[model samples]
Target chain A: MDFNPIWLTLKLACITTLLLLVIGLPVAWWLSKGRSFFKIIIEAIVTMPLVLPPSVLGFYLLLAFSPQHGAGKWLQQTFNIQFVFSFQGLVLASVIYSMPFMLGPIKSALQQLPVSLSQASYSLGKSRWQTFIRVLLPNIKPSLLTAAVLTFAHTLGEFGVVLMIGGNIPNVTRVASIAVYDAVEQMDYHAANVYSFILFAITFVLVTGVFIFNKYQLKSPLE
Target chain B: MISINIEKKIKTYQGQRILKVSGEFKSESITKIHGPSGAGKSTFLKVIAGFIQPEQGNITVNNNAWLDTVSKISLSPQKRMAGFVFQDYALFPNMTVKEHLEYATADNEWIKHLLEIGKLETLTTHKPQYLSGGQQQRLAILRALATKPQVLLMDEPFSALDPENKLALITELKLIFQELKTTVFIVSHNPQELDGIAADGAILSELYINN
Candidate 1:
């Protein structure tokens, strides 16, 4: 019911959105150009998260980051970071859980671009990396923006993964979705409605924004 | 300035048809490729420009081997140093004339001069979709020239333009090439586009040479 949960959700969305954009750009580019067998395998893995149950993802993440587990123990010993039951842990989990949302549109955009573009840049004597940075990235701006927006909104509304891995620890793991879940469990109708309305409004606006931008982009040739 | 000795094949679903062509393009010349569409005229242009690959061929430019099937060498496109003007324009449809001009380069006083000379100065902000057919073709010309390539490959570059604009562009391009001292290869089904532009000297029937 409180506004604090809403604020927390926004913060999480903003952070995840930025992280996905920073990481997803080059990743999507590689996926676009790669011919390796591992490419499809990795794509399948990324999209698996999209189709997988949120709770199952949370379970695996928790296993990977628990101090008693092999990966978690190694990370804790080397970097002194525990991914389970922490806000940072939640962010990592969310990023992993949402990888497909960012990668798909980006891959599609890169695919739609003609190979002649990079070739054209090359014919001008620019190197491969230069052509990618200068020519290719500029062309895929709309897709990049779309990836960011979808990832942000998707992360904001994430629930099962946050609850399972984050353990609903207030201030540290108590995301707004979890708060709404907690309100419903206690049968507090007013409080539940408040959190629910905020989440609904945020997602509604985000989707509407995507459509608006998409329409404008279609009218323009840039997208 | 550029030379290509290559044998390529266009592999359709049925079978591959070999395209064997070799030639040199010296600076200060306009080379015209004249052939029927199925003769792989455009395909050869793409091979020299590094957009297409030959099954078993060698492509060398300015004493460099870009592709040597016998030697198992395939260089990336960026290293090829070519300028290509597609029959389709291939302009970044979203970009403006200014951006396209900038795409060609900003340092050359000659580029700036060409902008004014071609009368493209006023259309710098216009996108290709908004441009007239002739204007879009000029945009392609502007882009190719900016690359400062040793050789330029054009695929029917003027096929869509009106006579006046096409003639004006050819004039501007010729002047720019003269000043830059560069080599160009233009693809034109029209004898008129090839007639005046291929001023260097005849190398073969329907082909010309500069040196």
Candidate 2:
């Protein structure tokens, strides 16, 4: 009946969604431009998370962030940050795991917009940055909302990556998904059911909201 | 004078075709460009507006180099300061009629004058989606003029207007172009669309590009 795991899961999802949104906007915009070999490679890397199993990503992240050697060692010594088996580690893993959910919708929406929109803005003496913020981003509101909600829901339901890199450790790293597995393993059916229902209900509401909002915005120009 | 000697390679459905245009346009005059379909008419306008970069070319506006590939000096679209009215109207769906003009210039009086010229004073609150085709087209033209640009590029500007509205709008635009001394480039399939406006001696020049 401990609610710490639920709170921690919500916090992680919120933080991951925010971080990805800030990072994804520029990356998605760059990718949405006409294709090049370099861009194609970067896009493939970004999209890999969607198709690749979460466990594979988790395994690599664990190795790369382990404090014993490599990047993990440098980060731990220089920044005094330990990514493996820590709450911060869970946040990093969730951001990577939920990246495609955040990027896919925004990228496609940007690509779908008519090129003339930017051209018109530019011809009016608007700079590229000004055009992106004032014109391009405003036209894709529905897609932005969809991306944010999907990233949040996807992060909330994370299991494999969190379990691998952020092993169940009370409030620090024990999110709802990990808590459910721990409860079931301990034969605590009631606790497991509570955590499962909460996670399921939250994700269902988020996804349903996205669908309804998108349907309402079906008449949008970008759609 | 605005002088241009530009050559660009454009990909057409048939194959790769080159668009080569060489012309000298007098400042503050209007030029009507007529060409058949797939003749890269719109592409030519875009190149002058700095939307498309020509492979090798030089564009000098009033003796100031806007683009020179040899020296690698190409001004960005912002620096070029050309106003464009797209064939599709290209109005911002999120912005209202007034916001569009306000986005371009801070002069309230100019915006008010533009609204009256387009006969869109009452529809200032409406978004492009709410406006009819003709209304949207007028808004696009009005928005372009909002910047008070020295150079204006329009592609099929009056395609959606009725004959009555088209003539009226053209009459109003003639006075405004002269008053502002704006250099204008208009592309149209219809040869007679701007007969009187471009037929004025020394004020009009005609150019034709064939695929």
Candidate 3:
């Protein structure tokens, strides 16, 4: 019933989705268009979280975020930044955990598009950036919508990584999923039911919306 | 004049074959590249357009070196500004007929003129899906011409047109080419398809590639 966790979770999801889009768009574009052995390696790394256990990813992130270690120590010494048990830590972890959800659909959509579309744009005197924005982006709306929704929902439901990297801190690290877990741990069946129902309903709606959109895309002659 | 001397190795199902070509196309003339399937006609066009990199090549358009392997100077496609009508039409599915032209240039008068020439005035608001194959082909041609490019590359441009439409469109295209002084290179499997246009002030240059 606490509102702080809900607001924090929403904030985290929003930030994570935005960051993933900024980071994932180029990655997806490369994965779709590039032809190199390194391309396969990069793709494998991106998709690792999808198959690897969430706890394993969380444990690694937790170690990397610790101030005594490589990346964390460098970040702290250079920029006075702290990751473990912080809002930034949760965002970083969520972005990594939800990357495949954001990238997979987008890459598949771009791959499905005929390479001629981009070639046409280029021959029409548009730069690669211009073509990507004005032409390629508009044609893949359904996939982009699916990516955004899935990323947002996945970040919202993230538990293992969030718990490992960001130990529960009121109004900071605590999110809706963590709140539900805490409610059950305290034997508060009523609170757990309330949080669980809310999460379940929201996720169901988002996933259903994506499926309906995917169907519409299939029926679309333009695709 | 566009002078091209390029060598590219192509990997086919059978084996690797080198695509070696060297030619000079005059300004404001139409050059037809006739070849069998898998002759790398499309790949040749792409190399000129800066899409595909040839292992060893140099393409000089209007005295500007678009691609020079020795100096490692390869201008990107946007800088080349070569209008291309792909074999598959390559029309943007999301863009309407009018939007396609609008995306290329901001000149309303030019677009109006192009719409009239392509006979797509009524279908300006229609997307590629709503149009027939011939209409789509015409749209692709119009979209390519929208840029008023100095060099135009077309790959099997008239494949979908009916005989009557083909003749009429070819006549109109000849006048446009003459007026604009545009250099054109068209690839075709059927050599006689562009005869009408060639006879009408389109100086014919042939480059044959055997599969």
Per-model TM-score versus the true fold: 0.90, 0.97, 0.94
DockQ, prediction 3: 0.67
lDDT of 1 by residue, B1-211 (tens): 5666777767645576777877666656777777665677777888877778787778766678888889988776676667788777777755787777676576767567767766788887888778887777777877887867677788888887777777777776777777766667777787566565645543322452111
lDDT of 2 by residue, A154-181 (tens): 8988999999999989989999998999
Clashing pairs in 1: A122-B78, B98-B124
Candidate 2 deviant stretches above 4 angstroms = A220-223, B199-202
Interface RMSD, all models, one decimal each? Answer: 3.2, 3.2, 2.1
Q: What does fnat come to for each candidate?
A: 0.55, 0.84, 0.86
Give the alpha carbon lDDT tens digit for every residue of A76-135 in model 1: 899999888988888998899888999999999998898777766677777778777767
Ranking by DockQ: 3, 2, 1
- Model 3 chain B scores worst on lDDT over the 10 consecutive residues at B194-203
Per-candidate clash tally: 2, 0, 0
Cα lDDT of all candidates, in order?
Answer: 0.78, 0.92, 0.91
Candidate 3 docks at the CAPRI level of: medium
Q: Where is the poorest 10-residue window by lDDT in model 2 chain B?
A: B193-202
lDDT of residue B28 for candidate 3: 91
